[model samples]
Target: MDTSEIIGQSIALENVFRILAKVAPTDTTVLVTGESGTGKELLVRALHKNSPRASKPFVPINCGAIPKELLESELFGHEKGAFTHAIRSRAGRFELADGGTVFLDEIGEMDFSLQVKILRFLQEKEFERIGGSRPHKVDVRVIAATNRDLEKEVDKGNFREDLYYRLNVIPIVLPPLRTRGDDVFLLADYFLKKFCDKCMIKNLKISSKARELMRTYSWPGNVRELENFMERMAILCENQEIMPEDLPDKILSAGGVEQDKMPVMPARFEWPRLRDMDDRKMNLKDFLDKIEEQLLLEALHSAGGIKNQAAEILGIKRTTLIEKLKKKQLG
Candidate 1:
């Protein structure tokens, strides 16, 4: 699988990748648990792509989305006369996924009776088509995912205990985005670039203050929410740079910064300190030079690359600006 699709460098995300690498090769039943919008389906697809069944069909069905009466026919194939709506013989997900995998999304929402059939299939690797006289055997892997906590469901008698154990032979719990530090900015930047490119707009940059607000805001909808917000910004935001005022009210409130009070532009200067030098592991000369280069770049950017204006912004002579640009090889 192209693991690049799963973006994030946080320790929480790295742990999930480690487990996925070890489990993808095996046919052991996997139960993925996570909140909605945490990219459970994406993770499962990656699993199948990395598995031996990569070339085979990867079938998926939402156990909760389908009617209970028809879910049985959906999972196990049905004969023409299996039910009133079974107008003709049809292959279910299990049959269609022969030699590949069947992803049972929202498995926790499955009815108890259907759970037993799933358990039987997991145990025997065979199942009878609805209203059929004999069993059909198929070599297929099963991967189930749910937003609910199966253990809690089992305790509450809403889910079958035996089926829970069977499907959870290998459990992969995805961490929520809120707990993944700094990953918010990483994803925000990626999504912004992607949406901007798709919309054929100039790439937008998030201000450092706006980034701080995003980092502190709890993204309840996870990566999906971030992607949507970026798309909206790409289409709706007029400014090239996303400042504090550009963010939505929820984000501003969460960051405890009022919209009316928020600055339209970032502060021009913040005095550097000894800690900055220590953080960069640079001595006095190199540290000062790095700071000068950053200011020069910011001035040039603000002036739209006009040398006279950039020199004025930095309060330096045009000749000095040219000399600095030449020395830094930034011209």
Candidate 2:
């Protein structure tokens, strides 16, 4: 189905692709759900492209972006003089999308009253334009995407339950970027190359340390944020390689490398005193174990839970670190 456009090899994404492959050829209505910037619209486009109605027009409407008053006319064309601004009769999105596909983006934001009309269309494949005497039938596939939880909205009396059930015949949920593992680096590299080419500049490579910090930071804005950041770096980065210092402070802080919070060693090393152990009400063995555990945890965190990197930081073999972690029940 040429899902090459949808990037990511994570199991979470692969699962979504599998579902798409099975459902794209059919005329079943699809409901795509995900967090904002999770590529829900992109997925819907892919579905339309791979469907039987690929050659026809693919109409997209953002229900949330349009005003409630004018949205009806936008979806179903108003007749001439139907409203104050209706200069001439025009076809609506559904009519325009006849024999093709209709992508209703942010459908969860649709008005409850309008939702009744939508449900009617979904059931009967027909709708009437504003001030029109007759209903118009369309042969288009319906694909709706939303970041909002429609089921919750239905329970709250915001979304219609019948409409939710009608649209959710085939639900495709996209996973957030933070949970996609190495897909982050894959997408980062893709965006870096894309932006670098656009700017007519050499591609900037991300340093290993910078990549580690990126892996630790939760990307709240998902792919869109990463794409924007990569474009910014492409234009602003003077060096050919992106280092940890090139990343923003938020990422640095999330990775425990914030400048102001970094630890500094004393001028002279002082051995742990008896009073130090007594302060924590611990004996020598227990106090020393506590210190070891702290260092182990710190190493693990710094390495982003990579055993080999943590062992290198502690100057120990990976197997030895594993053994210690297992002994401490920290593995």
Q: How many Å off is the CA of 59 in candidate 2?
A: 0.2
lDDT of 1 by residue, 1-331 (tens): 4688989999998999998999899999999999888889999999999999999999999999999988998899899888888889888889999999999999989999999999999999999999897899999999999999999999999999999999999999999888899989899999999989888999799878678767766778988998899898888888878876577756644552233333465468667789979999999999888678767756765575577998999999999998986675444
Candidate No. with top TM-score = 2
TM-score of 1: 0.77
Report each candidate's C-alpha RMSD, comma-separated, in the order given.
10.9, 10.9
List the global CA lDDT of all models.
0.86, 0.87
Which ranges of candidate 1 are over 4 A from the true structure?
256-331
Candidate 1 positional error at 181, Å: 0.9
lDDT of 2 at 164: 96
Model 2 clashing residue pairs (backbone): none
lDDT of 1: 0.86
Model 2, position 155: C-alpha lDDT score: 91
